[model samples]
Target: MLKFVIPAVALAAAASTPVSALEVTKTATIAAAPDTVWKTIGAFCGIGDWHPVVEKCALSKKGDKEQRTLTLKGGGTLLEEEQARDDKAMSYTYTILEGPLPVSDYKSTIMVAKDGSGSKVTWSGNFKAKGAPDNKAQEAIGGVYEAGLKGLSEKAK
Candidate 1:
């Protein structure tokens, strides 16, 4: 009885570790040029057309600067503060300010590369869920991301 109890406790401890440290990445090839795709994606408050879950996005703040807020559908909002950007690198990172999502330290960048006559776009991020994000939470985030990329591909063309 003692042996079984010890092992069970150890297993539980390992399972309880916070599910924070997850990276979800998705990529696609767009028919349009990288500049065109970037223009559509980098547009603040214009994400509603691409992100399926984001019913609308309005600029909570304005400026060619860091830190901005975007309100989402279903009573959730996110704050993004820019980390870096370069036309040559085609990448940027932002931290989240507020939201219902489990992720805490969330930052992502979209990179573009010339693939033959088209452009290859890669979206990647690393974050840790506030607590433990169930499978449903993970799937929801992933689906939204994929939908956004697909929408960009279609609209950019």
Candidate 2:
């Protein structure tokens, strides 16, 4: 009887939980070495150099964590904080502090790995849609990845 009661309470509590995150993942392959790709995108501020939509990136520090404010081409700013980075692993994770993307609680990671004579790149994120439909939010982040990967591929070549 006690086991039944506890299980019922747990299920009731879980049913009351709110919100779900929408996930997005995108991948690309570039004809560059993994280490070279990491060098191209390793720095927290290096995104401004390769991301097509990012006009410039200004970096600041919040204690030990690094933050970057990206200036978009048409006039918008995206502020992000570095969560963790691994140069040897060719990966970095970050969270959005503020941005135009239609997402809340946004977190993303980009990774690079060697594939034959080239590099494979991946960008992925999870967030709950804010003020927009879920599909719209997905499209926004997906478009950013597509453009960024395209730019990186061109630059790496």
Candidate 3:
């Protein structure tokens, strides 16, 4: 009886704790130079230009934060706010304000760096699953990153 009670108590405590966030990261090597890669994707709304699924991007300002509303090809929209940006570092970070993604508290960063004679682009994100299992959410984000990186690579060439 004592052993069973202890195990049940532990299970209850664990169930009450919040779920940990999951992360997905994807990288690609581009034939272009770092500076040139940054110039191609540096703008806040440039995702529309290089992300294959993005159909349109509308930029707007809210207080000091720059926000972009991305209209996706199949008819979904994502509203994201720029959290941090540094052209010198060739990196920018953003958070989802509202979107159809299967994750919550989603924050992502994209960075470009010199790799040998070309550039390496990295895109990573952290978030908790929402209305879906962790693996599903991770897969969704991974697919998005993969598609975007592929598009970016093509544009850089």
Using all chains and alpha carbons, the TM-scores for the candidates as numbered come to 0.72, 0.88, 0.88
lDDT of 3 by residue, 5-123 (tens): 99999999989876677999999999999998998895999999999999999999999999999999999999999999999999999999999999999999999999999999999
Candidate 3 lDDT at 26 equals 99
Clash count, one per candidate: 4, 0, 0
Best by lDDT: 3
Enumerate residue pairs that collide in model 3. Answer: none
- Which model is ahead, 1 or 2, in terms of lDDT? 2
Error of 2 at 48 (Å): 0.3
**Residue pairs in clash, model 1:** 20-128, 20-129, 21-128, 102-130
Kindly list the per-residue Cα lDDT of model 2 for residues 1-157, writing each as its tens digit.
Answer: 9999999999998888655878899999999888888888859999999999999999999999999999999999999999999988999999999988889999999999988999999999998899899999999999999999999888885
Candidates 1 and 2 compared: the better one by TM-score is 2
The order of the candidates by lDDT, greatest first, is 3, 2, 1
